[model samples]
Structures are given as structure tokens and as C-alpha cells.
Target: MTLDQFEARAREFLESRCSRRGPVATEWGSGEERLALFHETTDEQERAEAEAALAWQRERWAAGFGWITGPVEHGGAGLSAEHDRRYREIEAEFDVPDMAPLRIGLGTVSHALLAAGTPEQIATHAVPLHRGEAVACQLFSEPEAGSDLAGVRTRGVRDGDTWRVDGQKVWTSNATFADIGLALIRTDPDAPKHRGLSMFLVPMNTPGIEVRPLRQMTGGASFCEVFLSDVRLDDALRLGEPGSGWKVATSALAGERRAVGDRSHEMNARAMALLATLAQRTGRADDPAVRDAWVSLHSRLQIARFQQQRMQATDERTLTGAERAIDKVLLAANYKLIGDLAAELLGPAFVADTGEWGTFNWNRWLMGSMGYRIAGGTEEILKTMLAERVLGLPREPQEMKR
Candidate 1:
């Protein structure tokens, strides 16, 4: 079917299936409602919410909506970039099921498998991911290797038919609940740091794998720490050539950075609206400083949206590593600007647990606003990347390896 035809059908399907008691049927509308419900849910309501969300995704996957940019052979619709963008637009208006935890696996590793895995591996794993039957998480970052990923000490020793893994990974978001992990480990310790690694698809249920949720300042379990001890994986589960794992890992990270840029556009819009609400409620909408801040934030948000749209529009996808740094910088700045404005506008109300509409919530944004910059790559790393790579500046001295 044509892209338009598919989008129309998807919208109709969403309207028909979404709970009427919640928000609109569009993706964002539905997502906002679902997020509110998700955040406010009690332990008893969590399962019911999760099941409802899962069922919604199942329906979309069956109808060819969940995997638009995916390979045609792997149960995705195999549509063009425009088709994917259009689908996301239609999806934003309704409160639909969420799969944020699954995105890194399906969008990144599934594609990586198509690029580097044996055909048998793709056939065995890709379709189940699209159907939301399994979830995947990354096992790259370690206690020692945050931004300096090549410094990871995770080891995978060769066994007769399987490899034995032992390592620890930190900031492993969603690892505790994931079905599998895309682990990168040192298969040849004597080789150069970046050259000795190998990638493996390791089942989370393996006997030696342990997952512990790491709570954030926001009181959320969005990140975790993982311990792998003598976990075994068949050679067939390896991705790419044994010593060429950096290529796979780099490809996955590049895709992740680009995806972050795209998603930030929608997120910025919501942030602006929330700020606007605060401005109007506090009678700050007419203040000169508040107006200037709002305008500045909106301008940056628009530029981010345009850049993201341009990146998606190009078939070759020209968002290079440095351009991604630019996106990250803008996202960080926008978050801080919006948060500051919201906090300022709320004034005395911001510090109190007023139980009012937007009072206590200010603290969440105030604390979490800078998380994106620090989480993905630190601001210093991004600035260095932009200076040395994008602007052709001289390289700085290498720091001591921790």
C-alpha cells in the first residue's frame, strides 16, 4: 500500500483502539496521557497499564505501524524516510502504547544485525523484536568506561563452542527488564583497546547475568547496572568479525545520537507548553525578561526541529558525529532555558510542596534539565568533538586513562 494509505489506516486503527477515557488518539496525545498514568501508577495498576500498552503495540505491529523504518524482510513496512516521518507525525496525536525501552534494540541492533549478522540470526531475532515479544538493552558502558568507551574491560574468553563473559556495565538503561543484551567485550586483550572487542547477543536470562536497577535523582529506574559472570554465548550469536566489533558499536552509537535529535524535537515542544502554562499562571507572560526567554527558547527549538528534519530528509543521512554534537548542545541548552523560565515564573511557589498544578513539578525539571548532556556525552566531550572534527581545530593532549 502507499504511504498515505498506510498512515490513514494507522490513524483509524489508533482511534478505534485507544481508551476513550484517556487523551486524544494521536501519538503525542496518547503518549502524554499514558506517561501521566505511568508516572502516577500504583504497584497494583502497573501490570494492567503495561499489558494495555503491550496489547496496543501488538496491534500496531500486526497492522504494520511499529516498524516503519525497519527492513521489509524483517516484518517492517520497508517504507521511505518520508513515510517514516509521516507515520511519526500521525502517531504523535494519539495516546498509544510505549516502547522506549525496546527502541535501542530494535532500531539499532536489529539494523546492525542486518548489516553484520548471519542471515539466520536476523531471521531468528528481528521479527520477534518488531512484535514486542522480546526487548534488548546495551551492555557497553562500564564502571571505568563512560565516555571513553574503548577502555571497557569486559572480557569474553573463548570456549570450545561458546564464549565466557565476565564484566560490569553501568548506566545500562532498562537492562533489568530486557530480554537480551548487545554486549561488547574484549576478546583479545593484547590487541589495541579499540581493536580487541567483540559484540555478542547475550540472553539476559543466562545463569550468570545479574541486573540491578539504578535509581536516578528523579526517582526513576530508567537506568541500571549489569553484572555478567561467566555468561555463555554460542559463536553463532557473535556480531561481525571477532576483532571488528568497534565498527558495529560505532554504527549503533551513531544511530542512537541521530535518533536522540529526532525525538528531542517533540520533547522540546512539550517543554515549551509546560513553560507557557507556568508563565500564564504566574502573570509572567507579559514580563519583558520572560517574553525574551520564551522567544529565545522557541527559536532554538525550531532550529533543532529543522536540523533534525533535514537530517531525516536526506537519503544519505548527513548528520555526522560533529553535527550530532551540535544537536546535543542545542537540546541541553533548550532544556536548561525552559527549566529556568518555568522555575523563575513560579517564584516562591516553585520551592514549596504546594500540591498545586505546576509547583512541585518544577523541581523535576530543575534537577533533570541537564541530564541529556551529561548522560549521552558530557558537554566538554561534545564541545571537543565539534571543535576538532567539525571546525578543524587542533587536538588537545590525551588525558591519563583511568
Candidate 2:
């Protein structure tokens, strides 16, 4: 269908299902921004949000709007990415449940599965994930292997038709409630570090797998430290050919970076609005320094948005690893810029947790913004990749083995 037709249908569907809401109004100190870094919610609140998101997703999927870009066999509409983008634009007009929690599953994990998983694996996981029937998390980072994903020490040994996995994964987002995890494991210690890794689709409920929530400074326990001890997995759960995990991982990481970058524009808009409100409230709207900061941030945010558009225009199937790193770097930098501006605007109120509604509560966004710098890929690592691969710079010398 044409864009107009699709948008009209989407509008009709959304209006029929949910009430339309106006653009968020500025509430000065009484209202919080929509771009939340960490949600400090009770278990009941979290569960209710999750349930609402799932129900909304199911309804959208039943209407053939859930996974617009997914294959028809996988319960999607088999539409173009532009169609998906338009649907999201139309969706923004309604007051729907928050669906941010589904990003890791629907964007990162699902993309990885489509790239490297077998037909059965895709059919089993991707469809449910798209329908919001199942949630998935990435179990890639470890205590010793943050940016250096190839150095992961999680081990998996094959035993006939099963693989026994044992190791610990830190900074595992959404693991506390995930139904499955796409884990990277070391299967060949004798080989090179990057060559010995493999990926697995492990059921989170499998025996010997434990998840412990890690509280963050943002007052949220959204991340977790996962321990897998003698976790037995059938060989059918393997994601790709043995020892070919780096390929699968790089694909997923690229998707993660793209996803992070994709939302940078929206995030920047919200942050800019919040900053403007703060300046007005503090009577600093006329300050030259504040104006300069706001202008600089707006320019940088536009750059980030342009970068996202460029990345999207490129065929993801053909995007090189280095090219994909650009979005991540831009996103992290934009987030840091927003946090810094907020700090400047709020001054002392930025650091302390006053009982005020929007003033001190911004600490969550600042802390979370700092974490984004290190989340998908660290700034230093991504810059290194860009310099070496994209800029024709000489590679950093590898340390000689003792």
C-alpha cells in the first residue's frame, strides 16, 4: 500500500483502539520528561506495564502492524522498513502503553536471530518475540569482557547432543524477566580468543541458570548479573555453526548500535524541551551562556539525527561493521551532551535528590546518559574501530604474547 493509505489505516486503527493525546505539555516543575533513563517503579507497577505492553503488542500483531518489516511466515506483514517507520509516526499520536522494554527482544535479539538462526529457531523465537509472547535478552558482556566481547570467558562444552554452559554474565539488561537469552560462550579454548566463541539460544528457565538484579545509581534494577552453572542445552539451541559466533555477535551488536542511534533524535527533542522548561523556570532563559548551550545541543542533536537517517538509508544487509559503529558513537555523545546541559541548567539541584518533581528527578537521566557511553560500545573502542577501518589509519599494535 501507499504511505498515505497505510498511515490512514494505522490512524483509524489506533483511534478505534486508544484515545488520541496531544503533544506533551510543559508542566514546569510538576511534570517529568517522557524520556526516562531508569524507572523507579514497584513490582506491581512494572508487571502492569509489561502486561499492558504485551497486550498492546498482541493487538497490533493481530492487526498485522506488529512486525511490519518481518517476513510473512513469521507473523509479520512483510512490509518495507518505510512502512514500519510510518506506522510508528502514526502510533505517536495515541496514548499507548510504553513499549521500550521490548527493544532488546524485538530489535536486537530478533535481528540477530534473523541473521544467523536456523529456520526453526527463527520460527520459534522471532514470531513470539514479535507478538510479545516472549521476551529475550542478550547475555554477551562479562565482568572481564565489556568492550572486548571476544574475551568472554563463559565456557560451553559439547556432550553428544547437549552443551553444558558455565560462567557469569554481567550487565545483562532485562534478564530478570526475560524468557530466553542469546548468549555468547567460549567453546574452543585451544583456538584464538575470537575464533573459539559460539552463540546459543538458551531458555532462561533452564536449570542452573540464576539471575541476580544489580541495582544502578539511577534507582533502578533493570540490569542483572547472570550465573550459568552446568546449564544443559540441547544442540538444537545453537544459533550458528560452531566457532562462528563472532559473526553472529557482530551482527547483533550492529543492530544494537543502530537501535540506540535510531531513538537519539526523539531523546534529544525531549531533553531539549525539558531544558527549555528548566531555563524558563529558573529565569535563565535570557542568559547568553544558556542560549549558547541550547543552540550547540540542538545542532549536535540534528547531526545525530542526520547520521541516523544516513544509516537507515543504507542497506543494513550490506553495512560494514565500522560504518555501523558511527551511530553508536553519535548517540553516546549526544546523550552526554544532554546530560551536561541539564547539569549546567540545574546546577546544585542536578546532584541532590530534592523532593521536587522534575528538578532533582533528572539525576536519573544524567546517570543513565553516562551509562550509555559504555553500553553498546565504549567511545574509545568505537573510535578506534572508526579510525582503523573507516579512516585508513594504522592499526594499534597487538601486545606480544609472553
Candidate 3:
């Protein structure tokens, strides 16, 4: 289809389903403060949200808007990347499903499948994920390996005709209701750490797999710890050849780094808007100190938004390591700055039991902001990566073995 034809089709579909959000001005200290970086929802709430997201995605898939850039064989539109970009721009103006529920499935898992999954695997798994028949979550981080992803200890012992997976995965989002997990497990303990690993599209409902929600300081369980014990999965579920997982894993991680930053722009904007309103409501808007900090945080957020946009505008194939790391670091920095400014504006309101509109509500945000610094990729790890990979600095000395 021509560019104009695709744009027309998307606009027509969105107009029928949802109204346009032309200019939404925030009411001072009112409306849903919804300033959460990590969402906390009960099991029931999560199921409802996931269902809504899935229904919308399925509708879109039926309408030919789902998986706009994915290949036809994998149930995508088989269109150019530019077409996918255009579809997003058109969809942004309209009110639609939250889309958060399917983010990993489509953005990271599906992309990894395209890179490493066999054609049959893509048809059976990735296609359905985009079709909203299933939801997928990343099960890469483990208790022992968060930043050092290769140090994972999740083991998948080969048995005749199947593999038995046994290990624990921590900090997994959407594991509670996800249909599948793109899990990385060690298949060869004797090989070098990175070379021993393999990736799998593990069915979450397997008999021996368990997902336990983790309560965070924010008083909500936004993530989960998953345990697999003797859970047997078909060999067909393997994402790539044994020992090729490192390559497959990097493809997924790179997609994740790019999408995380791009997706955070709106959340940060809502937070900054709330911060500005809090200053006004508390009569600190005129204070020069508050004003300076607010402007600084706003400036930082704006720069981060631009960085995210620029990164998004660039072809994924061309993004350098430095380019991808910048947005994540900037985003974390802004989260911290936003929290600090909110605290300054909120005085005793920070911990007050009395429910003030914009006051105590920021408590949740503050907690998430601090935790986010270490989530995704830690600022420390991303910095070291930039130093060594992009700037050609000498590597950090590895500790000598005992």
C-alpha cells in the first residue's frame, strides 16, 4: 500500500473506535495523579487490564494494524519500517488500549523470535502474541544475574524428546498472567558462562512452574519471582540452537533498551506536570529554589524526551551502544530529580497520614524512582559499557580468581 493509503486506513479505523486526545491540559492537583513508574495492581485488576489490552490488540490485528512491521510469514503486515512508524504516529492522537500488557510480547519477544526463531516457532508463538491470543514476559534476570545477564544459573537439562527446566527468575513483569516467557537458562554448566546458556519460549502454565508476586516498597506487587522445577518443555520451544542464546539474547536486550526509553516519555511528562502543579498548590511555585529545581528537572526531562525520539527515529540497525544507553541513563536521572523536587515541595506532606491531593500521593512515585535507578540496566553498568565499548577506554580489571 502507498503511504497515504496506509495513513488513511489507520485514521479511519481509530476514529471509529476512539476519540482523539487533541490537547489534554492537567487540572491543578486533580485528576488521576497516575504518576507511577512501576504499576501496582491486584490480581483481579491485572487480569482486567490485561484482558482489555488483549481485546484491543486482537481487534487491531483483525483490522490489519497489529504487527505493522512484522513479516507476512510471521503474521505481520510485511511492510517497511517507515510504514510501522507512520501507523504509530497516527495511533498516538487517538485514545486506545493501554498497550503496556503486550509491550514485551511484541517489542522484545517477537523481535527475538524474528531473529532466531524457526519459521514454525514464529507462526505458532510470535504470531499469536501479536494477535493478542497470548502475552509474553522477559524471564532473563535471575537472583544471581541481574546486570551480568550471562551469569544466570537457571538450568535446562536435556532429556529425551524434551528439556527439564529448574531455576528461579526474579523481577519478571507480567509473569502472573502471561501465556509464555522468553526464558534464558543454562544448558551446559561445564562450558564458559556465556556459551553455556540457551533461550526458551517456556509455557508459563507448565506443571512445575510457579509465579509468586513480590511486594515492593510502594505497597504494590508490580513484579514477580518465578520458579521452575522439573518443568518439562518440548524441544521445539527452544528459541535458537544450543549455545546461540547469547546472540539471540542480545537482540532482545537491544530492542528492550530502545523501547523502554521511548515508552517512558509520556510517564515522565505526566510526572513533571504533576510536580509543577504540586508546587503551585503548596504555594512554593514562587520560591526561587523550587522554581530553579523545577526548571532543571523539566529541562532534563525534555532533553531525555528528545534523546528518546532521536533514538526512535534512527533505524534500529544503526543505533550504537552509546546511543541506546544515553536515553536509559537520562530517564533514570530525571526520575531521581523529579522525586527530589517533589520532596522539596511536599514538606511534611511527604509522610503525613492525612490524605492530601498532591502531597502524600508522591510517596509511591518517590519509592519507584529510587528503585528504577537500578532496574532495567543499572546506571553504573550502562556507563561502564559506554566507557569501554564506545570510548575505547581500558576495561575494568577483572578480579583475580582465588
Task: Give the per-residue lDDT of model 3 (tens digit) for 26-100.
Answer: 666457767567877787898888999999999899999888888886668988777887888788898787888
Number of backbone collisions per candidate, in order?
10, 0, 0
Q: Give all TM-scores, in the order shown.
A: 0.87, 0.94, 0.95
Q: Which residues of candidate 3, in runs, are more than 4 Å off? A: 22-25, 320-322
Better of 2 and 3 by lDDT: 3
Candidate order (TM-score): 3, 2, 1
Per-residue error for 324 in candidate 2, Å, reads 3.7
- Decide which is better by TM-score, 1 or 3: 3
Per-residue lDDT over 1-402 for candidate 2, one digit per residue giving the tens place of the 0 to 100 score: 788888888988898999987776655654545545656665556667777888899999888898988988877788777788778877877899988667788888998999998889999988898887987889999999998889999999999999999999999877777898999999999999989999999899999999998888766777789999999999999999999999999989887887676656655676788788888888899999989988887887787777777766666667787766887787777777787877788899987877766677677777787788889888888898899888999999999999
Give the clashing residue pairs of candidate 1, or none.
25-94, 26-93, 26-94, 27-91, 27-92, 27-93, 27-94, 28-92, 30-94, 30-95
Q: Which should have the higher lDDT, number 1 or number 3? A: 3
| Lowest-sum lDDT 10-residue window in model 1 | 29-38
Poorest stretch of ten by lDDT in candidate 2: 29-38
After TM-score superposition, what is the CA distance of residue 168 in candidate 1 from its true location, in Å?
A: 0.6
Tens digit of lDDT per residue, candidate 1, span 362-387?
Answer: 67776676666676567787798788
lDDT of each: 0.73, 0.83, 0.85
